[model samples]
Target: MVIRISKGSILILCLVLTNCKDSNKKLKETTVVSNIEKTLNFNLESAIADCQTQLERAVPKLTDLTKHPRFIEKEDTDWHQVPNDKLMWTSGFYPGILWYAYDVTGDNKWKKEAIKRTEVFEDFKNITEHHDIGFMMFPAYGNGFKIGDKKEYKDILLTSANSLATRFNPNVGTIKSWSNKMHPRWKQHITIIDNMLNLELLFWSAKNGGNPVHYDMAVKHAETTMNNHFREDLTSWHVIEYDSINGKVLNRHTKQGFADDSRWSRGQAWGVYGYTMVYKETKDKKFLDFAKKLADKYISLLPEDMIPAWDFDVQSDPKEEKDASAAAVVASALIDLSSFVESKEEQVKYLNAGIKMLNSLSSKKYSGVGKSDAFLLHSTGAKSLGWEIDVALIYADYYYIEALSRLKKLEKK
Candidate 1:
């Protein structure tokens, strides 16, 4: 306006204009950062795209060379086919992976591959010796039934539940994990944290009109596990031997972990996933509360990377390897667990923990999705104590896909 004004007034007006310009720039910069945070939070679409790419690379190698997907990438990345009749604990996961690939990509190639791999498990549905029927059938037949609702898939799952039910010892109040004769030192019965996983089969059977005994068996097994398999801190033991005559807990031990008193990461994952499953099937508050307790204990012990060592008790050893598969399993379970919690803070805590793990798993450090024949690598299975160490395991691949698939669904909703 060029009106007459004092010198000090002119300087003050210039200072005010400069401050306004600085404030606008700061606001714009903050807005850009906020947008970046939103974009980077969890991109489900990009994750799914990465999965499709990973599967396209990984699945063909599995199907082209092997009649059954064995998953221990051998010489020349040849699909090392394991005998389907061996009844390995992870036999079902291969087919499950195929099913998931089919689910996410809607590719008939993956579906046909899944079906071909699943057909071999026809014999698995009738075998009753072990407690991995859920692991063996659900990922294959359960997803088969889910994707198509085929009567055959339903029938196989039902029959497998019956076979699994027969292993439940009424005298011991839990499903026999393995033959008592195999581990006769217990002299009664043996159950494991792994057994909790098998209860999903029983629950599904009971809910789907198979048998009430299946349901009863599941409840009893879960109750037994909740009482004996867990310690005061909610960390689980791998196995619990019981007195066959009186159902008394004979001893608690660890078969696949660092020590008897140590926390096996996968075993804890099994417990968390199984109990959350029980709650899902029964809507039981006790199971939900127990799952939350276990989740809290697990989250508290997570290393800086948010991944767990093969055993929580391996703190004494700097050479201890991280169980990325266990982390994947727990991450998958936590996504589901978050939905059951009534508290918002608890829900956010669980969900963020899962998202952090999924992010870590997808990073270059842990995700060797395309580098080798395996879809996901850096998984430490059974550590150096067992045959497989720092290798890509079929279960690890299965659960990694599963966790991604789960988060994608949640994001869509």
Candidate 2:
């Protein structure tokens, strides 16, 4: 066939060819992307099933450990009375797991128990001037209030938030919690990254109660922690010294570790979880970037199977071992940190690392199974106190369930 074109028709023909080429290129790219997504979808389904199994095993123990004034003894025989004092911290972790179980299984039992047990905080009005009130309150009441819409939880949260806000010392630009009459060194208002957890309560309270000042106060505390508590490398000490009288940053030190500069595994885990949480609440790129930086460094330090010792830098020639509890907490935190990553591959890597650690814990050697202590496997409390060591710790259960919850959410997504 003879084809004849005028000058105007020539331009139109060129335009048509260009448009067809562009469309072809676009379609090819779309097909590639679709294939990649399909591969990812398949992998996620298999990985999620494996991850869910481990998390499922964690739920029952997390439940029994957080109940009443007692837990099962390791002797594997009977229920032992947990000191009335210890119950508060243990109780702090219950609601999150309960709610999570409900979310995953749609189990009314889980929701019912969660709602019922969280009521303990209703009568539990006293807020301790401690670094752990976030873990001690939010998971029980603040989370309950936020998720379940329980008025009692809200009331408890408001009271606790008021008390927490009061702990903010203007001079230190942070909350003052650690103090010991017997040990004068423990005195003075200081900043620790761990406070990042509790500061969320302040944010929650401010948003819920129409108080902007509480939010601003929380920002100040977090800023102070960001500036002072972290080292130049962003690895953190357990404590940072401040001039409580003048609100000046003084020094960074370790409170519970072997030395001021040595890295305590659990302390770093707290940093990992706390800063990631701070990023989630604030949406500040600085906090998110800082969290990613810390997570990168922390993840690099994980041993085989991604579990870390209590102290990452501890020397082994003298036979000092790592704290398994620290590994558990960090593993849990890493699972949360995974959600914040920009890349699917990075998220999968962190998720896999967490799963590796969890699988190791489920193993016979470290889990301390059949012992009946209501704890999982490894924890090291103050050896100076002659207390917990290599035992399943409550916070471990908390993070375990928290990680599991995150995994469950990912599965649904």
The model with the greatest lDDT is 1
**lDDT (10s digit) by residue, model 2, range 190-294:** 666567778878888787773577788888887778777777877788878777798776667766676788877777877777777778777888877787787
Q: Each candidate: what lDDT?
A: 0.78, 0.63
| lDDT by residue for model 1 (127-219), tens | 877777778888889988886455678888999999988888898889998886666666668898988878888888998889988988999
TM-score of each: 0.86, 0.77
**Regions of candidate 1 where Cα sits further than 4 Å from its true position:** 1-41, 64-67, 70-79, 181-185
Clashes of each: 0, 5
Model 1 lowest lDDT segment of ten: 28-37
